[model samples]
Target chain A: MEDKVKIIEIKKSVFAANEKTADDLREELKQKGVFLLNVMSSPGSGKTTTLVELINALKDKIKIAVMEADIDSDVDALTVAKKTGVQSIQLHTGGMCHLDAEMTSQGLNGLSNLDDLDLVILENVGNLVCPAEFDTGAVTSLTILSVPEGDDKPLKYPLMYQVCSLVVINKIDVLPYFTFDVAKCKENIKMRNPNAEVIEISALKKEGIDKLADWVLKQVKNWKENK
Target chain B: MHELGIVFHIIKQVEEVANKNSVKEVTKVVLEIGEVSGVVPKYLHDCWKWAVENRSEHMKNCALEVISLKATSYCKDCERMYDTVKSGRICPYCQSKNTYLVTGNEVSIKHIEVKDEN
Candidate 1:
């Protein structure tokens, strides 16, 4: 160890290159007319269930696909495939908590063609923290916060709350029974991201989903118009 | 949650600086952690304690100094910028949606104070 040569202090980001590549991937997705939605949340936040409902709602208006990123499991992809009857791919990151652009590009490469689809939702590895730091070629980042997760999640995980484009306050069917304060959650989320659009829904009961789907379609439309 | 990772980054930076300076002892590590970075100061300090305790030789005497930089969104509507504490998404001035983030997303090693054992 004494023989090793040292030098001046180098300030290098551990994630700078990855962020650049993610930006490149986002540009590529923009070119293909594919609006990518990177869905991130803690495990069992109704992300997949909401996706299934979304797929069912807009299958006629748009050709949709899904890339489910999990730590280890084909089960989610299978469920999505069976539920939506659309092309769904599974990405196993082994144990990594996040998915970078390079990781997502691999999945995009495996897809049929970017031009053939209007939407590609990357169901990112479930976590409010690490995935927030890594972008996965997504045009819009959607975060689902379930009622069971509590309202303080926005305040607790400010980065995720701030970066998210849409905040889906899920599990609304049980809102009457549970102590989850919907308005409080919205306030907390707005405290972290004033521009963050929030929608209340129950993925399990298929309630308030039309508005969510509409918000997504509207985002796609806005992206096309603005871009 | 990501405090450990940041600690690792901090250690790596301090090690490089220590090696470059060729000083035996490091008195303090000055860190600039921006508000809204989702890193709690206490948690980061705790992580630093654990991470540095495992470090060898000159790292034992290192003191941590975390400087919090508060970031706030400025509303263009009222053309007023208010001092917002860490992790606020709304603008205190006009509450305009057109406001953008000013300077909250930072995790950098601004400066370090050191002394050589000589």
Candidate 2:
């Protein structure tokens, strides 16, 4: 007697399919004249504080809104809204560690009034691994690394460095207190992703905020001009 | 991050395939998970076990099989391949930093087994 079990050959990639959804979402965002930025970092990396500064810096030049995502909290969103006085929405991942393209789209739908917004920033759940794995349909993905996170973060979390378009080293004001090697950090990031842009900033003391603001404005202008 | 969500996506894909083939029951699902794909096989298995029981009646007892692929990196300077986990981006042989990942970064379904009534 021969084995009767039938094996169906299906060499399909599930992540690739999810990427298709992300691409579609990107197209939708482009059509809506919105530049979606997915910002990711580890917890306590000052992602909210950076966003608050970003809102203040870019809000005067462009229409900005933010979506804060966490496992279970509205505190960051509340802080962003209170500090920046901008349109802010909180998204709970319901135990999920990362946001996929579809989830980002759902959040955008819930955001309402996207018609008037030039940029929509999604503050992804604080984690180095999973957030880098999923494509959140953002025009650009930004990763924040604070002085306290150490310089070896890129070596440990290469995926985060590889996926991000820009890496912002926050808390530069406190760099003198920590042994964080900025040159070594940039080298590690470049080793992982040669094309990625690295910018150092102190979100608290407003150091290097002007350069970041200029880069954001340039990206937005390029998106509009190209569209 | 969320292996459960990934499991859900996998289940949806399997259900679609099963529906197309008119499968009465899905006996097993074989997934080819890359070592560097960031998906934990144990968590995926746990999620699959729970999801099949609650969601798919035909796949209530479906077994999940994961084939973890080894991560390998190719050294541009040495023209050699090495274990990515052990050697990392640096080539162990030539001590060169010019290296790139060749494989072990994929999450895909290899095949599936369906119950036969013949």
Candidate achieving the largest lDDT: 2
- List ranges where model 2 is wrong by over 4 Å: A1-3, B55-57, B73-83, B86-100
Model 1 alpha-carbon drift over 4 Å, by segment: A1-14, B1-32, B40-83, B91-100, B109-118
What TM-score, computed on C-alpha atoms, does each candidate reach?
0.77, 0.90
Every candidate's lDDT: 0.80, 0.88
As a whole number from 0 to 100, the lDDT of residue A160 in candidate 2 is 91
- Measured against the true two-chain complex, the DockQ scores of the candidates, in the order shown, are 0.17, 0.56
Tens digits of lDDT, candidate 2, A123-189: 9999998888889889988899999999999988888998988999999999889999999999888
The CAPRI category of model 1 is incorrect
| Candidate 1 local lDDT, A172-203, one digit each (tens) | 88777778888889889887787799999988
User: What TM-score does candidate 1 reach?
Assistant: 0.77
